[model samples]
Target: MPTAVPVAALDPTDPDAGAVAHYGDPAREQRLLDNAAGLVDRSHRGVLAIPGADRLGWLHSLTTQHLSDLAPMTGSELLVLSPHGHVEHHAVLTDDGDATWLDTGDAPGLLTFLERMRFLMRVEPAEVSADWALLSIVGPQTDEALIALGVGPLLPPDLLAVPDAKFATGSVPPRPTAVYSAAALQFGGWARRMPYGADLLVPRPAVPDVVEAAGVPLAGVWAFEAMRVAARRPRAGFETDHKTLPAEVGWTAPAVHLEKGCYRGQETIARVHHLGRPPRKLALLHLDGIATDELPARHTPVMLEGGERPVGFVGTAVRHYELGMIALAVVKQNLTPDSVLRVGLSTAAMDPEH
Candidate 1:
């Protein structure tokens, strides 16, 4: 119900209720994201602080990721599933020495579930989204921008490696400004080598100064959406719903550990992987340039060339700078990659990127 407010200094106008869609020129902002560093405000995401001696172990037993040995300053992704093995929630996790933070889009729902599951455990989960701010520095100039802001030298080489030697040598940086390795935070916030960038999780009050100090142009959700779609990453609420299975969206490889101990949806996941294929598979649809002037709406029916019945529905569509008009969709598994499809009167070519 609560909407995120943009930083006052940015003087951003809302394109949607309680959110800044872009800072005037979306195309230019997207161009900056592709070539140079661009600062993006991600305070709308959910942040939860989980603290206690049993925190890691408890979370490991509940989610899809293997978190028993997750080290401080390292990050990983996990999925919360329904009893029937459908994806209920998705989270990006990171741990500081003191507390493990779970960042998700569905913060309120995740908090409620975590609380109910903590009947007798030593772990304590609290929603701390309001107390912190999340910002991302994306593009080729990410390292230069961080160094300019005095947030260097970034986290060590092996994120999963034991910290005993580093701690013994007194190599760990002090709090606040310590840089986390982009490899560790792979899911959303942190940078990737191919994409080349990093994210900053800072205190809420420091947002204005941090954004200004980074000295980069700002990008809004529109640009972020285009990049994410281009990368073929599936996001909660967009590419997934309560009844969506992890395998259907190609999340099992990253988010779910097949050999890990049993969790809520392990049985169904194992069965699907070993015994059968998902009924549908995620794909990228390239919209025909001359088919229509308007972008298709979310959940618009997708139909095959000769079929009268719809085969699937569109999830998220964006006008990518390089790819033109592209959309992520879940189509029937039997649909061939080259098959042409229709959404309304618009035509699209299926791309099996996932």
Candidate 2:
């Protein structure tokens, strides 16, 4: 098989590969978490460009997330799933009015996979991360900072601003420079990028800190794991594969379009959603009494108490400070939330909502 390389060498076949991020130093995990709660630079994530006459219609027929509703300075969660309903990728689309750009995990070869699938469609998929910068503004105070940055005036009102853009411009020490207009879903950080060929300049590191405060929550791989699981979000590699469908990974809500007519795997997706139930369901596993250092690694089978047959496998695990040890798992649909299962020495219950 031809190997694929992005930021790090990856095995697309492995379910846990995307979680093994190779950003900066390992200690930056806290920084990432802080950035989630504050402001920070994270341009390593990949960007995909979708163009072509049928680009909008083509993508609308493929993934979840409403495409027709997308407008400038706004975005939504986009998910691509397998025919059986397993998650292929979880992406966020930021529409700048020209093309729909996808922001997603820096998985190896993902860009190639996207481009290769763009055959006869009007949609064009290409990587533009190298040509632009990406950053995130998270945390409770994100809206406050957005107002100070003056992003409100710069963005269009058809969507939203973070109440207003936050900035403190001037020669003074607290001169604000960073800003992004907000519109929905509890206004947070902004992901900025110039056109692929444009010479957009990113401010110096010191500048972002001076404006947004350098206390960005730098979430490492583990922090991301925790946040994702808490959000009940299905993972790509772990919860799904080429044989998996979106519904199987708890992504049946908005990714697949039943009435949009056929695409590559539309037949299978429709049949499964209409006639058959998904084979596997995404679940949250809350470990009982497992210490942060004692969690099991990936591919750990979850064994039902009375039955020797394994019911599912652990997808992602994290020892959240407030939530304790938790993981996302692919379990038999027969399993109900709060059902108990064992994985080695740790015990977990299915999340009620999963």
Candidate 3:
């Protein structure tokens, strides 16, 4: 992943300022993210641009979300599933008037899949990761921070737009095909609510200017991960694996549109939703004894107290400032919320939050 801007432009004393991890005081950065506002360089996230008239319709028939009527300047999320209904890839989707934007952790793989499925569709997909930069402005004052950076007006009207009742109409106005020029600043970029706050997609060359203008402390990936864990948000690789279904990780409502037209994994999703329950369900595990600093690593076995057999495994674990040692785990659906489990060497009780 490339650095958003020059390291010298940021605090030099904070060694990891331009790296993937934290800069200096991770705890202090986490506090700023929770209380005020902080900027995180997410340029590593994959970005793809899909242009042409058939973009929405083509993507609508391939992904789980209903994108055929996706309106201009609005956003939604979708999941690409295997034929048997397991989630293969996930993307955060939004569209300007002329083209659609797909953001994911695996841009190359997504681009390859889309290209292979193009057939005769008018859609043309191109990887634009090098051309754009993604930054997340999180916390209660996220909007204020963006305004201070002079990018507030670029955000869509409803930053928290989802694929639910609010956007049921699915009507989008026609947009002109124009290059992303200075005049396009009002609608050139896209912003959407994240688990921590909201993310802004901007031009790559302007990242340094934006960071300097924001004047807020920069946070590392560790702080972002902790906040995401606290929010109980399951990411693509950590909480989900190859055979993982959407319902297993609690992604059904927002990422899956059951009532929409037929898609690759629609049948399996519908069958599981209407007839049976997923084999596993997501849960929040509260580790016992906060005194110990050691936390269980990912994929550690989660077993029933005094039982010889393992029931589940940990996914994302973090030492949250407020929640202490908390982790998200995928456990057997049969296990009740009151079940006591053992994670690594520590005892854990399942929290009802998940």
Candidate 4:
């Protein structure tokens, strides 16, 4: 069950508090901003620590991100796929100096997968529930806020994972220095080990101020939707599933490590990329309607004019205060921008990225 934390407890001046009230709960939208601009206590996300001398080598073969050449203080987003190339788990990998830390959305599954794949490698995977907190801070000024926090320009335009501080002396260990996979390449977004998970969650005016100084809007889920649509970023669960492959989702965005040798799903991914074709494409849907607090049910059929066999489903919906409601959907590759699409009572303009 998801635990509820008081937003007022975070910080009275946090813009996140305003967003929470505007959307629903201030605590909920806290991490919507990129970097530390909107710090939400995201301890609920699972963090698994990979230890042992072969830690780097073991995970290198397991994940899509190349980790062998990974530099220190850097992180990469990776996906664990089924042998068929379908996404099984989405993760963020960071080398914290002594051990390669794999941050996955699945706490149990990640640990299980690692254990099952250990083979003869001299590495060990352990669950580190006591150590780190996983927070997804998003916002236009996210980088500025991280920089202000003493991290050097973390976040994609950089992908560096420089440490802001050691949360505790002996509380948690670090990843090994040598990189074992290509996924170790940096893209931006530093995953630091904060001492107490709760400190980063608490909203401090100082944190928001750093991003505000960058002159970017402090956004919540609404603004984030616009940004993702503009960037064509895919969200887990909403935009993908166990059956979804990186190729079908237009994962040209570094979500998959194409050059990384076989892991699970490597064969299917290769076949689809080389011989077969992507079945569907992830696209943005601009529908006409006022945004609502109650999200549309997942997998709700997205229809085209005449209610033809529904083209797709709502991947994610965000109420952009200014732009109204916008969503992402996976539709048949045959669908074109000119196609008139609909979902329930609303008509949508299918905007497929070229």
**The candidate that achieves the highest lDDT relative to the unseen native structure:** 3
- Answer with 1 or 3, whichever has the higher lDDT: 3
lDDT of each residue in 1-354, candidate 1, tens digit only: 113334343434422233456777777778888888788787778789899988988988898877777767666678899999999999877777567887788899999999999978899899988877677777778777767676544644223322331133333222211123433221223332222366666677778877777788788777877877877878888787557898888777557766667899899987777655788888899998685867787778899988999898888888888888989888888888789899877899888654
Which of the two candidates, 2 or 4, achieves a greater TM-score against the reference?
4
- For all predictions, the C-alpha RMSD in Å is 8.2, 11.9, 6.3, 10.6
State the lDDT of candidate 4 residue by residue for 3-77, as single tens digits.
344334555653234232223443334344423444433444567777677776666678666666666555556
Clashing pairs in 3: none
TM-scores for every predicted model: 0.83, 0.67, 0.83, 0.70
lDDT of 3 by residue, 100-211 (tens): 9888878898999999999999988999999888888878787676667555634433322223323434332222111121112333475655545667788988887777
| Prediction 3 TM-score vs. true | 0.83
Task: State how far residue 326 of model 2 sits from its true place (Å).
Answer: 1.3
Deviating ranges (above 4 Å) for candidate 3: 1-19, 151-188, 289-292
Specify the poorest-scoring 10-residue window by lDDT in model 2: 193-202
- Between candidates 2 and 3, name the one with more favorable lDDT: 3
Misplaced by over 4 Å in model 2 are: 1-36, 40-42, 51-54, 61-69, 81-86, 106-108, 117-124, 152-221, 275-277, 289-292
Off by over 4 Å in 1: 1-16, 153-196, 289-291, 352-354
Expressed as tens digits, the lDDT of each residue in 1-354 for candidate 2 is: 112222234445543343334345433443344343433344556667666666666666566544654455555455665554445677656555567667677534656666666778867678776664455544444444444544422242122111111222321221111112233212223433211100111233433443334333333344445556666666566555455667667554434434444445566665666555677777888888643347776768999977799888887776665667888888888998657788778777887862
Lowest summed lDDT over 10 consecutive residues: which window, candidate 3?
A: 174-183
Which of candidates 1 and 2 reaches a greater TM-score?
Answer: 1
lDDT of each: 0.73, 0.54, 0.75, 0.56
